[model samples]
Target: MTTISAGATDPISPGVRHVKRPTPLRESVYEALTEMIIDGTLERGRHLVEVELAGMLGVSRQPVREALQRLNNEGWVDLRPGFGAMVHVPAEDEVDQLLAARAALESESARLAARHATKDDVARLKELCKVGTAYHEAGDIDGAVRTNGELHSLITQMSGNRFLVDFAAQVDRRVRWYYTPVAPVRGAASWREHNRLVKAIEVGDEDKAAQTMREHTEHTRKAYHDLQAGSTAEPATDPDPAPRTRRRRTT
Candidate 1:
């Protein structure tokens, strides 16, 4: 069995520590802080002072301290002695690991969904795809990301495998944080892939659905690499130097 530590103690003058209970104050503070971190209201590398955070959330220092510790464990916050805490920014290798894990779990879920999904399950997944695509097209990247997650959650539910679903959910939370900070290079492609997966499931092609889902996740990793490369490369201003021209003569 795995045991996780809760770093909670009595609040000390608006410093980061831990709290002991699930009081209303703690719950409220946790929710408020979580929303800020997830929504980019709290930016990466920005220091989180316990006192300021407590003031912002309108809670006592104890609850804020506890919430910070929880967020720290969840990969949303980075705690240090002098700095208190700051938003956790995932490294490139971390992103790769998350995408790899997501691909594994989701591919299996897609296979099971293809075999066992009911008509209602198909309908719900179709609805999620529609909403996700609409959000992507509307340039609401955050909403698209959320709806995309919902689509995956629905697939996991349809798979009837509780263990896989739980693991996928945990991986997804960290993946979202990583993906959101990067530009939305593959949002359209992602939704289209979702559509294809839905179609495969609707047709009850377990093999094709699983294969497509795996490829879709692999594509995300590729897109991330492309985005990173583009950020570092010099801007291109004109067409390729070796542009092809029509042949003028025939022998």
Candidate 2:
């Protein structure tokens, strides 16, 4: 029996060995880091160190730095002069403004979709709803958020208006950052509302679709407010133990 070379692992080829190609560092880093920020894994106010992130992602510092800069430009991170980059935390008012804008854009999108959506568009909406419901049931809140966004995106595209589609896409990204963190707690009710919205679109009911879209966004805003209030009302815990008074040892 002939002995195989050390690098030859594949049975089909005598000399050819499987080679693992290195994934492009910047592309991988961008997606991995962005997903963490979007899903709240990175968390607000958390500082990002390029070295640490690069090491974690199995990449070099250059890619991490580039990714951070891109994130900063997108409002996902803030780079300070003295301190390193920190996750951008939206203020309450900022969140409110985002939701208000989403309400207006999406309401119009729903109306246009109701008027122009073909049978295929309605079927696609139903499929998206089913996928979103499955993800919600599985406790995969992030998955639900992504699929739900797709449903809305499809409707906006089917509206046959390019300008409205572009505006809605930009606003939707901000809406997603808020929704993903809060969805698991409100998944059930949200999915039910999505089903109702889908039905309205399917029947070509413009008024009903627009109204439902507005109400849906309003419900999300209410949930966000309640969550914020509950968090603020919770008692804060001291990180350190209380200091005890020292007794005199040399009396």
Candidate 3:
């Protein structure tokens, strides 16, 4: 994340220009803590201590408290009166809902990309598909997942719908989190499906492209359920009720 001064003219990093200005302490704290939670730095179900977070981030406890409150509202943290805040453990139902939403969005993206994609665009998609396939074959599940996301994001951009792009961006991280458990299970076949989808797009078959995406995403949804059913440590059950924190009402 690069800082931007008043007269900055250099091209900002793609997809993160909003971080240029001096961010408020509370938002900064929230963003940092959110990343930690998403990236597994703060494991699910672990308690978050405001004092420790404040000291780590070089801020006062007030900012951490405010950030935790905001995170709670956003479903990333659960706040309890006596226990304070803890990372929200994502459950199977939540995962199903998010992936269902993703399937709807990406299937449309594939249809549109087939309608609008230039030769160069198709070539790029093929390139990413190859990279993901190579990564999966090389036993680099992390690299395969990252490149797979990049491929979907690029296809979404080809749809020429900024709203769809932004909406997909919003849920992208959560989708990644749910995908982790099933990546290896879905690895080779997933990339093969990607190849088939790209071929459909290359031929400008809108219906075929959309169907391919739908099937591909549906396969992922099934893979997730199967993985959860097979895993002993999966967070399959619903979470305990989140404790409510009292907020002082202000005029």
So what's the TM-score on candidate 3? 0.76
Clashing pairs in 3: none
Model 1 ranges with Cα > 4 A deviation:
1-23, 228-251
lDDT tens digits, residues 169-250, model 2? 7887778888875676456666677778888888899999999889888878877776676632211121222232221110
**To one decimal, what is the Cα RMSD in angstroms of model 1 from the true structure?**
12.6
Alpha carbon lDDT at 105, candidate 3: 96
- C-alpha-based local distance difference test score of model 3: 0.82
Tell me the lDDT of model 2 at 220.
82
TM-score of each: 0.77, 0.78, 0.76
Model 2 alpha-carbon drift over 4 Å, by segment: 1-28, 231-251
Ten residues in a row with the worst lDDT in model 1? 242-251
Return the TM-score for candidate 2, rounded to 2 decimals.
Answer: 0.78
Please give the CA lDDT of all the candidate structures.
0.76, 0.80, 0.82
Error of 2 at 168 (Å): 1.8
Q: Relative to the unseen true structure, what is the Cα RMSD of model 3?
A: 13.0
Alpha carbon lDDT of residue 114, candidate 2? Answer: 91
